[model samples]
Target: MRADAGAILRIDELTVSFRTDSGEVPAVRGVSFELAAGEALALVGESGSGKSTVALAALGLLGGTARVSGSIAIGDIAVVGAGERELQRVRGKLASMVFQEPATALDPLMRVGDQIAEVIRNHDDVSAAEAQARAVELLGHVGLPEPASRVRSFPFQLSGGQRQRVVIAMAIANRPKLLIADEPTTALDVTVQAEILDLLRRLAAENDMGVLLVTHNMGVVADFADRVAVMTDGRLVEEGPVDEVLLRPQHEYTRALLSAVPRLSVAERPAAAGAAGAAGPAAPAAPARERYVEASGVSVSFGRGVRAVHALRDVSLDVAAGETVGLVGESGSGKSTIARAVLGLIEPDSGSVRVFGEELRRARGRRLRQLRAGIGVVLQDPVASLDARLSVAECIAEPLLVHARGLGRAERRRRVAEALEAVRLPAAFMDRAPRELSGGQRQRVSLARALVLSPRLLVADEPTSALDVSVQRTVLDVITELQRELGFACIFVSHDLAVVQEFAQRVVVMRAGAVVETGPTAVTLSHPETEYTRRLLAAVPVPDPVVQRGRRLAAAGGAA
Candidate 1:
């Protein structure tokens, strides 16, 4: 195959396989693509779909238990069979990668400036002071505030979005011919994600850099990529311009992926709109729900003096039984702080968190535990929250053992099996360890663990943020089914307004430890009264390329 004259990155028949315990498993099968200079291409698919494998293969990063074949080139440098010396010369100077998690990419021991400087020094012979100065300049270029002072801070000191910007600064420090970013915005809030994507796009255009973005988010793909390539299993199913693939997908797999994305409707939709028909009358009003929990003037602060951080200040919200309330905000906006207050995990400095009609502040020891027993919690990362040593049955049963000590072993097993069935998982998975399960399966186990006690309220914190689009839909469907089957009030805490639009009846928009806006989900999100809420909503990228393009033009015109 002939390489395009303007192409900065070129690939042909790239096949990658791993030597597993079972046998040789193909990860990428005869994949071929080209990325021209100053262009953005997205590789999208579910968890194990060859997209990430292809990215790693491009950088020759797949080393352990992996075999790679076929041609991979960056500019004039060959990557497929290059030696370590040759690969090193091509890596930082010609190509650089930005990983999904910024935390894993940066070193905690060293200052962020030093990290960027180290990369610069590797490619070019420069003085340490000069490199450090360049690092600060790069940070400022990436839109980080107080770049000079922030350069001295460690990765832990910076926020998630700031750390990502630092990583991007490092990737472009050497002015590489190609920049590969893999799920760069997966963990960010919608507004922050928009900023990061805008930064990447601007950097690519300004430097004429080729960006190969690997992500499962269709919205991000539409907003950032000029072209999109859909992968399934280990093969490319569809590849075309963003509009053709997203709006008019020819492949069944591509169509399914597009359909699975949760669409956020910004139009005024009645609560009972789904029931109205020409022949049938409107659906009956929902039954009146009792106020199960009320947080009155809740204020929570950590540390003291100048070091103290006010997480929640006079923030009050309530949830009725069988209703879902969303606590939506950006990072450091006190969303999780409010959730902990409801769970009786922390004591508020002032105000009261009443759960099941009992004030959490007044509740003590056995009473607090009793109140908490009625409230179940699901965290963001299942792998981190779950114990690797415990089997699925053991993980789910652990909660039951603590909450109901008198229950017999046989009864505990019965409850565990019941919870698993509710989440649509097979009984066979009960004996398997957490590592044996996929991401969606692990999250289901997390949900099952939360349900075993038959709680009246469930608090899920960014539960589906880490999942792929298709798997995210499946998990959400299970939640909807379970919520209907077991009528429990839900306090869903998330930065993703789109997910909130789908799951919650009411939404509370929080920022800087204060409640800026609150109303019905449809009305609040569709026509936000506050500018903060409107800004948050505007930052969310729709999956449609045509619509996204129009929004981009409108935003650009406004900026101009």
Candidate 2:
């Protein structure tokens, strides 16, 4: 592909490969694209599909092991084989990048303002005071609350959404002609994701900067980008206008991706034939029905005095046998706190938590261990949760070894193999390390490990948050299938209402450590009674451009 006169960033037959022990592994195979000024082009693909590799190659950020054979031109600078000095001259000044995870992107020790100021000073000749002032202005531009005070706060002191805004502020500090945002909203809440997308749109328009957005979220591409590029297996399968690609996708992969996205409009609550129990304001347990886990009037707080943070307040919840309950809330809203309280990971300041009819706080010694063995937990980040040194088999067998010591080695191995098969992973994967597996596979291993103990209850906390739409759908299907076959109760914690609507029978909305709303999934999402619930439902971006435009317009009118 040839670069047009108006193009600010261009890639021509960009092929990238990495030399590994097994030999050359091609990441991007002859991919070509262009981003013109004042336009937004999104690279949509799953993990290891070369979307992020293309962006990194454009910025000359690839490591020494990488081999590039094509042309990448960011204005007058050639990026494919440029030296460090030449690449440095182009980086940050002409092009910048906003990474996926803001927590790791920002320096923990330094104040946010200084970090932005440093970026500005690196690319321009300015005094420290002038740079500091510009940093504050940029922070304000990104819609950070109390920019003056927030500027002085460290990254650890701010919320996840606030930290992401600070990262954006730094990326745009030098006013680069091209900005590459890689999965910027993947880990954020629906409301915060919408806010960040709006901020990027405004900034791109105001500065007339070209944006290359790399993400697996088709909803975001539909709502934000002018054009779309679909990649699969290191190849660009399709590229066209957003509406054409999303509404009338030609490629099978593209169509599959669109289909995998959980839609709130089409989702229905689970049938009541085997519905477990109501979530909020728990009633007396029926004699025939079994309550797997229950937390009543639970209150938890961190620190003391003026520094105290009330994580939970009189929050009551219960999960019935063989039922799935979704817990939805924004960050720091105590969704995870409630999960921890139920797992006996943390003690509540007041009230009680009972699992299988045994109070968690009161259970001790052998009784406590026995009670804990019946509960399984799956965390958000599988990579962080799984040990790198351990093979897949060892990771899955760990629970059995701890909880079921009487089981012999052959019995444990058989259970591990069974668990892997349950999650749709082959026995061959048992020998592989966690690093060798994909994000979705790692999550499946996490599920297998959680299920190996044959627990009566499962707590999956944002297990699919970081996965691609198609992979996320597969994982959710695995969970549902396993739950149906095993008859285990579940508490699914996530901020994604669409996924919750599809997966959970009962829905609980939490805000400021209090249960704002709770009801059957369909009724609660489609006909919310509270403003907060309405806002959350509205914040979710649809995969259709026309619908998203209407939603944005309605939101703006409401704000006005």
Candidate 3:
């Protein structure tokens, strides 16, 4: 690829390899791209496809063990072989990075304001007070609430979306010529994801900064990127304008990727007979199906009187046998609280939780263990949930060893193998460690572990949040198939309305620790009664740029 004169960032024949104990592993193989001023170029692929490696190469952020070749130039600066001093001068001043997980990226000990100010002071010769003032202004500029008060807050005190805003504030503090955002919106909710994308677009336009977006979300690419580059196994197989690449892709891999994104239209919804009864507020009457798990008038509070936070307030929900109930809400909306309450992980201050007709809070030693055995849970982050040291077999058989005492080693191994097969993982994967598997494979192992107990109730909390679009579709299909075959009740919790609308028969919308709306998935999403629900629906970015622009314009008019 020829470098354009007007481009702010350009790469030619870039190759990167990591030195491992066995051998040198090639990650990026002669990939080339360019980003012009005020333009956005997206690198789209699954995990370990070398998209991130290329971005890291641009910033000269690769580690000592990495062997890099080819030319990477940010304007006149050479990045591939730049000295430490030269790289340091260019890093924050000429270019910046926004990482995926804000929780890990931001320092917990430092106040948000200080963190941003530190970045400013690192590159510019501004006084401490001046930098602090600029930090507060940046916070407000990024649309964070109460910039003055929030400036003193630590990362832990802020919500996921708020922390991401703070990270963006720090990244753009220097107004660099190039901005490299690596999966910046992967862990955020749909609404927050849209807001962050819009913020980046506006900031890039105002500063005429070039943006290199590394992501796996096709919808985000369609909405935000001017050009798209598709990567697979360290090679660039397809690259062109967004419409040409996404709508008329020539590569088979690109076509497969485009096919995997879940669509939210009514046509994709289940048949009317399978859908929950016509939309409206959930019927005051009880469901005829047998209730497998129930939480009534649950209330939970953290800390003392002055600092108390009401996480849940009189929230009531129930899951029937062989049914899937989706819990949808923004961060800190008490959706996870309901899951924890049903799991007996946290005791509610008021009201009761019942599982299999037995009160969870009152259940004692043996009874509690027996009750827990009947319930399975899949958390959002598979890596955190699975032990890194343990092999796949051990991870899956853990529940069996704990609950089923008489079950011998051979039986446990057989169960583990069966569970792995159930989730469409190879039996050979049992011997592999969690670290050796990909993100999608590890999540499959989590599902297998959750199912080894043959539980009657399953609670999956954002199981596909961090996965690529293709991987998410496969995982969701596996979950649906397993639920149908096993006949287990499920409480599916997620902020993605598209996935929820497809997977759940009924949907519950929560806000400020209260249930705002509940009804059939199709009805609730299509005709949201409350303004908050409408806002959330409007916030979802469709893959079609025209539709997204129209939605944004309609929302702006409504707000006006």
lDDT of 2 by residue, 1-560 (tens): 23335479989899999999999999999999888988999999899999999999999998999999989988767787678988887888889999999999998899999999999998899999999999989999999978988889999999888999999999889889999999999999998999999999999999999999999887788789999999988999999998899889999999999999988672122222112233334334444559988899999999999999999999999999998999998998899999999999999999999999989999999899999899998999999999999999999999888889999988888999999999999999989999999999999999999999888999999999999999999999999999999999999999988899899988999999999999888767766767788778778888888777776876698699
- Candidate 1 residue lDDT tens string, 1-560: 23335579888899999998999999999899899999999999998999999999988999978899989888877787788888898788889999999999999999999999999999999999999999999999999999999999999999999999999999999998799999999999998999999999999989999999999988899899999999999899899999899989999999999899887765112312222221223334667888788998999999999999999999999999889999998999999999998887888999988889888778888887888888888999999989999999999998888879999988998899999999999988889999999899999999999988989999999999999988888988998888898999999998777789999988999999989999888767766777687678777888987777777776687579
Query: Which 10 successive residues of model 1 have the least lDDT summed?
Result: 267-276
Model 1, stretches more than 4 Å misplaced? Answer: 1-6, 267-287
Candidate 2 local distance difference test against the native: 0.90
lDDT of 3 by residue, 108-184 (tens): 89999999999999999999999999999999999999999999999999988899999989988998999999999
Give residue 19's error in model 3 in angstroms.
Answer: 1.3
Model 3: how far is 204 from its true place, Å? 0.9
Which predicted model would earn the best lDDT? Answer: 2
Residue-level lDDT for 377 in candidate 1: 88
Output the lDDT of residue 77, model 1: 75
lDDT per model vs. reference: 0.89, 0.90, 0.89
Q: Lowest-lDDT window of 10 residues in candidate 3?
A: 267-276
- For model 2, state the Cα shift of residue 238 in Å: 0.6
Off by over 4 Å in 2: 1-5, 266-288
TM-score (C-alpha, index-matched) for candidate 1: 0.95
Q: What's the ranking of the predictions by TM-score, best on top?
A: 2, 1, 3
